[model samples]
Target chain A: MVAPVAVVGALFIVYPLVKLTMDAFTQGDGGFSNFAAVFESAAIRNSLVNTIVMSLVVTVLCVVMGASISWSIARARSAAFKALLWAALLLPFWMGVVVKAYAWSIIFAKNGILNSVLDQAGVIDEPMTLLYTRLAVVVGMTYTMLPYAVLAMNPTMSRFEPEFLNSARSLGSSRTAAMVRVWLPIVAPGLIAAAAIVFAISIGFYVTPVLLGGAETPFMATMIGDDIFAFFNYPRAAASSVLLLVLALVVLGTALKAVGSKALKGGIAG
Target chain B: MTHPPRKLLAAAACALALTASACGSDTDSGSGSDGSVKLTIASWGDPFTSATREHLVKPFTEETGYEVDIVDAPGKFVANLEAQTQANNVEWDLLDSTSGPDAYIAHDRGLIATMPDDVKERLLEELPEDAVTDFGISWSVLGYVGACNAEAVDTCPTDTAGLFDTEEFPGSRTSISTSPLVNLSMAEIANGVTIDELPTHEIDLDRAFETLTEFQDASGAWWSSGDQNLQVFESGEAELGISYSGRAYGLIDSGTPVEVIWQDGLYNPGFWNVTEGSDNPDEAWEFVEWIASHPENAAAWAEALGYSVPNPESFDFIDEKTAKTLADFPENREKLGLMNYAWYVENYEEVNKRWQEFLRG
Candidate 1:
């Protein structure tokens, strides 16, 4: 049983990674020409830059949005409020990412739900082109990443003691002050975790970005996919995949370090 | 140490499961040995696939006594081909694709084997030098024509220039959504410059941007899927839009009041290529010859799939209305432009750079 499991693991995960890495370094007609081309091309660089920018924007948005939403759920005074929060958070999780992106697209399209509603309500004069813009991509990515953040923060948020806020309030600390100084510090690690997840997912996302973004807004993962499948250049695609893994690792390392620093400050880690 | 090793083992097992799942899909098997060659032919998505199988494959099987196995190539054609090629595994025998950079890449990689000798000879005799390539033949011509909801726009824009003239035709429009190919070409044409006369070495990047800006201002949204185009026409999402003629037929079939104008449409042939070093070359070649030859087969293919066939004679096989609707008719055929695919292949890196820069702004 153990041997079979080990063999399966090695064949799938280990072999592919090893094969991909070997392929990336290979140079020839069917080889590193793609990687060389990727490096030489300005489009790839622009896409990489766009991907990073979009990922950062989404991570920031998720942190702020996730923290606020989770805080309300955490501080809910009634069962109904908690139920509502859970319903909202879990509802998105049940829906497919592609389905959600399509829903957002329909709402954001020129003759989409938003424009139609707006038109009926007399809010705007005409429809706006919201489907194939960076703004649309950001919205889509943020929506996809929202549940991860919410789920991550939920447990930590619920664990947060109301007595800490009460103590701060008793000491004449305003509600905002208590949240900023007391509550934020305790939830900071979870917030960092949520941000990291959102950032990592955003950097490598394809579906939402491809559907919602313009040609210029190609993410690194999508570019790698294009190289392997669209371009039929495996060596280059492999190289790009390796690069993506590296980028992801660097991001994860930075996030870990940040979390470690917070843990040390809070005396959670020695 | 025990706990860490257990966790590592678990992680490793999960990774293996994913890899196994990916590899399980790529397997090559011929039809049961009854002297009937079972060839797996792959194309893009549905209605087209179903139509082609219905109209062409079924009739071919009925006549030839060879079983036709039609499959939708996973994801896009190039990616599916790449994965198979990368593993040195050839599950797909015949593939339907246009002469794009990947075809060139595949040819370079020695992934495409020889076509049937007679098919090659026929192509050389019939197709112009620009039509055929070493790797694949011109299967069907892809074009971007001005299709309109007949109810909204009384006159479909006749040419590429008139497409951007929003004031004259006041309604939403869509072009080939993702690929910047048509967009760049149209921009040059709209800018009063022909692509043939433009500097071969250096593409005017500024003109591309200027063209897209005009399109973005005038158009509703960039369409990404065939379904999106179907919805656009069906729901009257756009008054006039550029789409694959095949997709437009789907709308018309569903009783959408949409019509096409093939004037100045970019037409390129979709090609069929066999995987190099396949164990079943004879079987594959047999399937290819059956598909490419026989106007009836091609006509049934076009009728079933809603896509236009390269066989000029196939038009006669379909109904009069359907025949007129084909992208390669005399009224439309003359205006159907061909891009120097070889030029695009060689300078893809440069073209992509300019395309990205243009899109960013």
Candidate 2:
């Protein structure tokens, strides 16, 4: 059984990865020249930086929002309410990313609902510039990835023991102190897992950023896509992909180590 | 519980059945079984597809008794054609390509078939001189013009220079960031080079880049797609932009206060080419010939979609007011610059790299 799975994994996953790695190296003089090209090019460098910055920002926002929602759902008295909350959170994930991005574009357009509403309410004399900006891109990405973050934290939040908080309260600790000292530590692993997942997904976002962002917002995935489709520079695209993969792995590894492997597994499983 | 495993098994079985059925459907829909010849034409999104289907395809089918299937092939036209060629199973009978590097590449790679002699002769006689090529026939021409919001700008600047003239047209502007072909050409035209002189002489790249940099300085955003360009104007993000004439016309039609500056418009023609391995080559040629020969159909298509057909005679069928908005209006045509497709084809890689660098700045 293990052999069958191993064979399938090697054939399906490892083979393609190996091929990509080989292409990245062998395309230009069969060495690390492709990687050098990627680093030296200002466009690629900017895209990489943008990707990291956007992913980090999105990850942070998702973690905070997800944790808040998860805490509420877990602490709710009515099970029906918790189910409804889960349904609401899971709704966006069911829609296609492109569809979601397009929907956001409509909402974020200058004459769109948001501006129309604001203008009607006398918020301002002029319409706000909402579409084709970095803010719009972040909003779209966060909306799409928020569900994942929430779901990741759900199991751990639901399994949280109220007794720990009660015990800390009995010892004359303030509510804030109890949350910071006791409750936070218990949920740290779940938070870490959520952040890691969101970051990993955020870094690879292609459609949302492209649809929502203007010239200032060139993500690494978009650059890679351009290299492959527009420029037909497969080697450079592969090199960029490898670089992004490495960065993602580094971030994930660091998070896993900080959270501890056992705790993360328990958090996810629970 | 044991119930969980049972549910999982049932879901797995359902997924397997769905996958098998999807595969079955693919094979079933691959080809026509009836005796009547069917041809598949790869097309871009609406209103181009809808226009073509309504005015060209339906009429052709009615007249010739051949079934035509319009397949959505936007940015992936070349890739799809290449895949079909590689797989030795060409599904698409005809492809809609721009009469530029794309046609050259297709011709060079033997992906497109040479036009039948009669079809070529008729197309050469009917269409513009540049539109008739060995591999493709020009279907329509879309102009890249300076579009301005009438409500925002007090006096609309009429030339390409006005796009960069911030003080005269003091509002946000945008241009196509993905491709520099139109912008660079327009920049050359802006720097005192006439449309006729552009193809014969080498364009001054340094001067063009300098002018573009000035324009970029004044611009608030850059659009990558036709929809984005329309949105920029429709949403008031941009008061002025270098837009495809069709999109500007769309805004105008939808009651937006937009005006298209015909001066210094860059007219780029899209071509219809029969695929190399087309099973219905004769039928494909007939369809292309019929569409090309019928000026009324071409006019109807042009009227429906805000682009011009290459057949100048089609103007006879088009209304006078709508005809003036098209690229081929004699007065506007004189001012419009034809895209130097050869130059772009030769220097695409270098230009694209430089363009990316420019955008980074």
Candidate 3:
């Protein structure tokens, strides 16, 4: 049974990756010429940088927002608070990533619903041009990614012992200080893990940025997809895919190291 | 140990059920195949395929006893078709594609067979001088025009240049961001160049880029998907969009104050070509010929769709009442201008490279 599963997985996942890596290194009408084209083109370089920067921003935002929201929901005093948090959490689930992006577009577009609403409320004479800005991309991405982040941290947050938090508070620390020191340290692994997950996802994202971002914004996955699917340049697309995979692995490796080191130090101390 | 066997059987059954459910969504019904000549033809959009099946394929199969399978045109179709031809096992009989890349690339690679004699004969009899090319036949005049949000802008922009004029039309604009053709073309028009005088005809990237920047500055969104394009119009997210003729029709039908500007609309054509290694080439040709020339079929297919049939004969049969309801009537066609596909095909890669750099900058 294990052999069969392993064979199937290896054929589907491993074979594609190995093939991609091999294609990345080869050149010509049929070879690695496509990979050469990727590096030669300055546009692809900019797209790569943009993708990394966007991924980092999205990951950091998700980590901070997810931890805070999860904490609120997991430790709420009232059933109403829990219910409200649940409602907030589930709201995004009902709205598709594309639809959520559209909603943001409507709010941000020159004569969008949000602008119209704001104009009706007499907040400003003119509607603010909020759509197609980088801010919109970040906001749209964060909204889509927040659910993943929250789910990742929620289990750890729920299982977290209140005693540890209390002990830190009792030791002459304020609530905010205790959170930064004890609570954050305890949840550090979860945050790192969540960030890694968010980073991997955001790195590979295509639809959100294209819909919400300016023409200048080109993410790696979108670029790769365009290169291969749109332009039909297989080798370059495969090369870019390999590079993206490498970048994802590096991030995952770093996350693992950070978590591993913390655990090692704790083990020695104990 | 008492209930271990029962538990194992139940677990195995549950896993099997889950596996079955996951694979169920993408399965073909095979109702389309009844051991006859199975001709598989693919196109891009869902609406296009539905129209082709209902109006085109159903009639042909009913008349000729051939099984025409209309499938969604995947991006991999061309590459897969090429690979299959090389391996001597071609699957697709007919494929729908744009004139430029589809014709140029596929013909150069020798993946597409010559257009059947009947298709050529019909084209000679019906179409204008410039419509037919060496490799494929032009099927429809696909064009982009200014679709304005009537709610935001009282009057739709009269000319193509108004689309890029931020001061006159100070609202969000939508255009395709992935490919540079539509945006660059609009930009050229914005820069006071007439459709005939566009620098891209000489294939100048710098001039095109300069034009694009002005349009880019005015743009609020760069849409890719059909859904995105339609939503922008319906929800009043944009004041004007460089929208397809079909989408413009849908928006108008929905009672949205959105309107289409026929002036300086950029038009192109799509082709129906047979794969080189197709086993059912005769059947494919029959379907193509029937779909292309059949007036009742083409008119029914074109109505309320994103594409208009390229056949000129189909227009005479369409009643004025129905023609008025359709987006791309003969009167509308006379106003819009089309791009030279032969020119575009020869320089796609070069243009795409420059477009990438222009977007990056």
Candidate 4:
């Protein structure tokens, strides 16, 4: 049974990846020609930079938002309130990524809900440019990624004893100073682990960016799709895919080193 | 050209089963309990294939004894055919409404089969002579035209130059960000290239991109798909923009104050193709011929898809208002420019690379 499961898993996952890597390397004169072509193109390079920047921005946003929500859930006096917070945190599961992206598009559109409300509230004379920009892509991505970040950090936060902070407060440390010294360090591993998860997932995002962001906000995923579908350049697409995969793996491996896999898994599993 | 008669040649071809079998074809056509032959055709899928079924496929099956199996493969003709070619398990007997460029590429790769002479001769009887080629017949016609949210702007630009001139039209604009060819072609028009000169003009990237910058500067949102094109206008995200003529008409029909400008549009068309190694080319040809012979069915099919049929007689069946909105309408056809697909195919690699870069930029 184990043999069968392993074979099937390898066939589905390992086979495609092996084929992709082989295709990436087999282009032109072989052995880095495909990689050279990838580097040679100004568009691919720009998209690579765009992907990293957007993913970093999204990861940061998700980490900040996730930390606050998870903290509230952990510190809430009422057990029922904590459950409700967890339920709200898991609300993203009810909606698909594409649907969420479309919702954001409406929210950001010039005549859409957000703008209309802002205008009615006299926030501005005109609707600000929000849709199809780098900022819009980051917001859409962060919304989708926030839950993962919360899930990763929630476990660590829940396990913490409120008495520890009380003990710090009793030692004449101010509440703000106690949070900076005691609460932050204890949860640092969880934050780092959450960032890794968010960053890794954000790097591979395809639909959210395209739906919420436009051509001006080119991401690596969009270019890879264009190469395969529009130009039918499979080799170039594969090369880019390989590079993206390497980037994600590097991020994950570095996080595994910074916060040991056991601690990261504990934050995820605890 | 007038058609001689409305008789489907496929029925006769099926009656002449020996000749069809003699083409070294698959002996068994996965025949039904009644022992009738079935022909598998690849389609772009709903609502394209849905329209085809309602207008042509069911009628062909009813008139002729052959069954057609539609597999959803929208925008995947070349890719699917290439895969089938490599696997030597060519499944589709026909490809419905394959884009002209895709058909040409597939033909060049020897993935498309030549149409039977009887079917070709019959199709030529009614179809525009130029629409039928060695590989396929042009079945559906579309256009990428200027669209405006009339409620947002006091006046809308009726031509490419007018649309890009932000000061004159004076509204936030949007254009297709996906196709470099469309943006570049429209930009060239803005840069003072005449419509007559546009058919053969190679895009000057430096010149085109400069004007394109001006075009995009006025745009509040750049759209990629038909749905997104409508969303921008519906949500009032964009005031003036590029839109598919079909989608613009749809917006107008749905009570949106969207105006479609046909002047300086791109004449994009889709073709019907018989695939290489087809086990039922005769049946596929018969279906093609049937579409041409029955103009009313063609009109209904085109009506459902918001595309135009090649048959001039089909206009008799279409409503006056909707007929004028189609790409092949006499007035629209006279002014619209078509991209040189052959030219794009030749320079597709370099052009796509630059387009990707420019889009990101």
lDDT of 2 by residue, B222-287 (tens): 888888888778777788979988788888988888888888778777788898998989888878
Cα lDDT of model 1 by residue, B1-361, tens digit: 0011233334434543564465465445655577656777777647667766776677778887767677776445666665667677767777766345456656655777756666677666644455556666666666667677877776767767777777777787776555655667666666666534432423465766776777767665556566777765554456786877777776778887777767666675667788785556776666555666677877777766556676666777988777767766667667766654456666676665566455542
DockQ of candidate 4 relative to the true structure: 0.23
For every candidate, what is the interface RMSD in angstroms? 9.0, 5.5, 9.8, 21.5
User: In model 2, which regions exceed 4 Å deviation?
Assistant: A1-22, A26-31, A111-128, A249-270, B1-38, B58-68, B83-91, B97-101, B104-119, B276-286
> How high is the TM-score of chain A in model 3?
0.86
Report the CA-based lDDT of candidate 3 relative to the real structure: 0.70
DockQ comparison, 1 vs 4, better candidate: 1
Task: Kindly list the per-residue Cα lDDT of model 4 for residues B1-361, writing each as its tens digit.
Answer: 1110123223322433553344342222232456567788788767888998888889888888688778777666787677678778788888888876677667877999887677778778888886788878887888888988888999988888888888889988888777778888888888888778887888888898888788777878888887888888887778987888888898898778888888887777788888898876777777777787899999999888889887999999999888998988888887788776667777777777777777774
Clashing pairs in 3: A26-A32, A27-A31, A27-A32, A27-A33, A28-A33
Candidate 3 clash total? 5
User: What C-alpha lDDT, on a 0 to 100 scale, does residue B123 get in candidate 3?
Assistant: 64
Look at candidate 1 and give me any clashing residue pairs.
A229-B79, B51-B304, B51-B305, B139-B270, B140-B270
Q: What docking tier does model 1 reach?
A: acceptable
Lowest summed lDDT across 10 adjacent residues in model 2 chain B is found at B1-10
List DockQ for all candidates: 0.26, 0.33, 0.27, 0.23
The regions of model 3 sitting more than 4 angstroms off are A27-36, A77-96, A174-177, A261-270, B1-36, B74-89, B97-101, B116-119, B126-131, B149-157, B161-172, B185-201, B234-237, B304-306, B321-328
After best superposition, candidate 2 residue B90: deviation in angstroms? 4.6
- Candidate 2's displacement at residue A198, Å, is 0.6
